[model samples]
Target: MERTESNGPVTVPALPSLEPIRLVDRHGRRTAEPVVPSPDHDTLMALLRGMVIGRRFDRQASALARQGGLAVYPSSYGQEACQVAGALALAEQDWLFPTYRDSVALLTRGVDPIEVLTLLRGDWHSGYDPRPHRCAPQCTPLASNASHAVGLTYAARRKGEETAALVLMGDGATSEGDAHEAYNFAAVWNAPVVFLVQNNGWAISVPVEKQTRAPTLAHKAVGYGMPGYHVDGNDAAAVYAVVSRALAEARSGGGPVLIEARTYRLDPHTNSDAPQRYRRDAEVAYWRDRDPVSRLEALLRAEGAAGDADLARFADEAERVAADVRKRLAEADDPDPEDLFAHVYASIPPSLAHQRADLRDELREG
Candidate 1:
């Protein structure tokens, strides 16, 4: 679509193709013709390292949940490509709005593993300070962060900052009302934001087939008057390239772009979810063969971009991260009950003050 501005007409990005853009096949072979430019060797290696670490982190977090270190965990085991690539695609100045399942993405963005898991541990409202890291709290409510992303980017644009916001959601979030509202608001206001829907084929047992009737989630972008991209979520290189391009366009006043990453959630939605009751073993096995970490590792080895020593280094780093996470989390202090009222507001309200006093008196009596 073309729109006339003060200086001639500007061409909006064309509608995305129905096929998810793929740079590499499931077997880790480069596609005959990639839909977008592939990342260079350095970027590929970086992506590989990030995915390896992310997968390790995800596994460790899950183990912690089972061992009582965390209250629960939403594993991103099969979707490391989306998590690592989404974080790497952004500039440091850009903001990231992530969902509960995106802890790996937050870790990729340099958030501390302890802080990332703090919310799941039920110790704090948010694990880390949102402003210092330019990442919002990992939102648990479906699609609510979408509107927050739009509002932040729109405000940044007004202040003449070349900042872009990337909001990550799952396939289920697309079905939420806030997601649609955010989509419409971003397009209408031309907010410098990108929405990445990690469509992992299920909304907690309800498959994508039952989610919407749209040919593809990317098609929904046309209704919002914004460009949409459909990309193979397992292909780390493709995800990074597409997201990088979308973020660039957003920062350059091209408005918001919605990306539907075709990936799969290999694990249950959370620790409490029972995949055995919802999905078949055969289906899980199929996605396991397309594991993002191994896929990128294969491509690197095939291209001679990564040697055994290099791969070993990445693996060692991953192990170290896992060990550190385990050690620190185990050593964490128990949360103080009084801390709940600490960050609630700048000044305590009358009702809360009364409650605090009552709690204090009750504790004293005990």
Candidate 2:
């Protein structure tokens, strides 16, 4: 440890070094040897298809928000590789704890596009049932969902269930107390959980440089006594391989693992945020050129795993899904005024009752 020059706290460099794992390059060429057997042609084709759909979904969601359909939306624009791969890594019995920006992951996990966007549209508390889908509500309050993921996995362990929980969070969430607590708890209890942190180079408008002085976010797992994996988030094959191994280990009784995926957010943090406020046009253009969808498409064409027909089919499918998303969102019913008072208290308090009645009367008058 070194002492500070003044009253400010001193800092020490204690974490181990990190090198990100990558299986593919920007040209979609293999960059590293695989530990497990290479994914079959079908798997690669599916991943490519999912990435295309996710990209289209992100674009459509952003357009809907601008058209006054959704109250807000967080696009996974350039990070679709991480989202699709992580979602596909899970088993059917596993649970997913997703953040507001992980709608792509949710859709890949078999969630309805409309149901997943309901909360973002400000129509309902949660649009899907957690019990059936094994997915928690999409979280918005930073790392709060991390704690909930830990709790759910811990409960499953107590019940003697062989299952794991995969949590998807942003780099900004690592700064929160709930994320730290969840990491410590999961590591200590040896809970079956995989934490996938999509370190997309920015926490809202803040850059990774401003977020920490550590070599990388993966080092954050070392202090919690869990193995940390650094992966190129833009490489879908790498993200899938890393997450799949981690989840398999967790369910087999190994402790949790934390994966920090390095990627870039091509779009603004949300519809309300402006990328030009803190990021450059060149930087965004740079990432757009490295877009996951295009990369995977290139690889498939080169490998002969997908032909022109396959590419066109995937593109058409993506457009159809996007159209459906728009139609369903536009046709969804309006929320009832009484819903504001729901799920808050077992019995309504006098103040809430009065407020509910006032809202109902206003609605009636309108």
Candidate 3:
């Protein structure tokens, strides 16, 4: 990748590096040129804790899906580094626009686990107040939230607010027309927004190879007059550093950025998916060895940044979170059928009102 001058006009790189940027290698060894300085000790510790808890939360959600606690769940298994870093990189005032697969990210942002799973539980449109948390609902339609993020950031800029937005999507999302429009609008308007594509090798059943012909998904940003970043998504430190830098630049009016995080999805796309039908066992085994949580833990121990006690504490915290998730989800009340007509509008339309009445009548008859 070509480097731009520190002084003078800002320039977008013509292309992202052919290889993904990596701070920590698979063996948890530091890279030769560790481009971005490692985050301070405390930040590093937080990243580790987030990833650890995120993995546990992911496993619990997947189990819930299998046991009927949720209607559906898109587990972020093996993508904890990307999920945690994305949430941690943002400031409290900034917004996070997440897709269905980003529950781990939402959890890291301090959203309640029960609320985070409410949509998957087939209950509410959104369980939490977006305005209060600065997080939109977990979008199910691929890439649709991209436009919403751009609109919010642009509007915030117009209001003289310093808020920025981070939009998370999968590799499959990059192909959608909405994603392209969002990219173009954000660049043209100089909106403070960032697009993060977790290139986890597969888009449900389709691999990244079929998604685009571009060298890397990050290169797509060059066409929109914005910077693109390619990072090893399995490396928590690298993901955090890159996303943190992108958010800082966007908040400073440097415009938008697109980041492609190379990672893998160890579990099926959702509980219903049969990954074995498409991918082989050997491929999954390869990525299992590069597990993000273990990789980060190794780095911590190697650097003497964390010891056995610290690791145990993180594990204990994760167990507590899992237990809490189990209890709250089990205790969650079934959604009110009437709620279907509740949040869509301030005043219900006549047609929907009639339908709501019919549903109520049917329920009463039953």
**Candidates' C-alpha lDDT:** 0.93, 0.87, 0.91
TM-score of each: 0.94, 0.92, 0.94
**Candidate 3: minimum summed lDDT over ten consecutive residues — where?**
1-10
The residue-by-residue lDDT of candidate 3 on 93-125, one tens digit each, is: 999999999999999998988889988988877
Worst 10 residues of 1 by lDDT: 7-16
Candidate 2 residue spans exceeding 4 A from truth: 1-17, 32-37, 343-347
- Our model 3 lands, by Cα RMSD against the true structure, at 3.0
**Residue 65 accuracy (lDDT) in model 1:** 93
The Cα error of candidate 1 at residue 229, in Å, is 1.0
Cα lDDT of model 1 by residue, 158-257, tens digit: 9999999999999999999999999999998999999999999999989998989988899899888888899999999999999999999999999999
Give the Cα error of residue 74 in candidate 2, in Å. 0.6
- lDDT string, candidate 2, 1-366, tens digits: 544766675333235336678777788787666544456678778898899988898899999999999999998888999999998889989999999999999999889999989999998888898777788999999988888888888998899998899999999999888998999999878899899999988898888888788788889887787788888788888888889999999999887889999898887888999889788899888888777777877887888888989989988999999999988777777887688899999999999999998998998899
As a TM-score, model 1 comes out at 0.94
Prediction-by-prediction clash tally: 0, 0, 0
Report how far residue 242 has shifted in candidate 3, in Å: 0.6
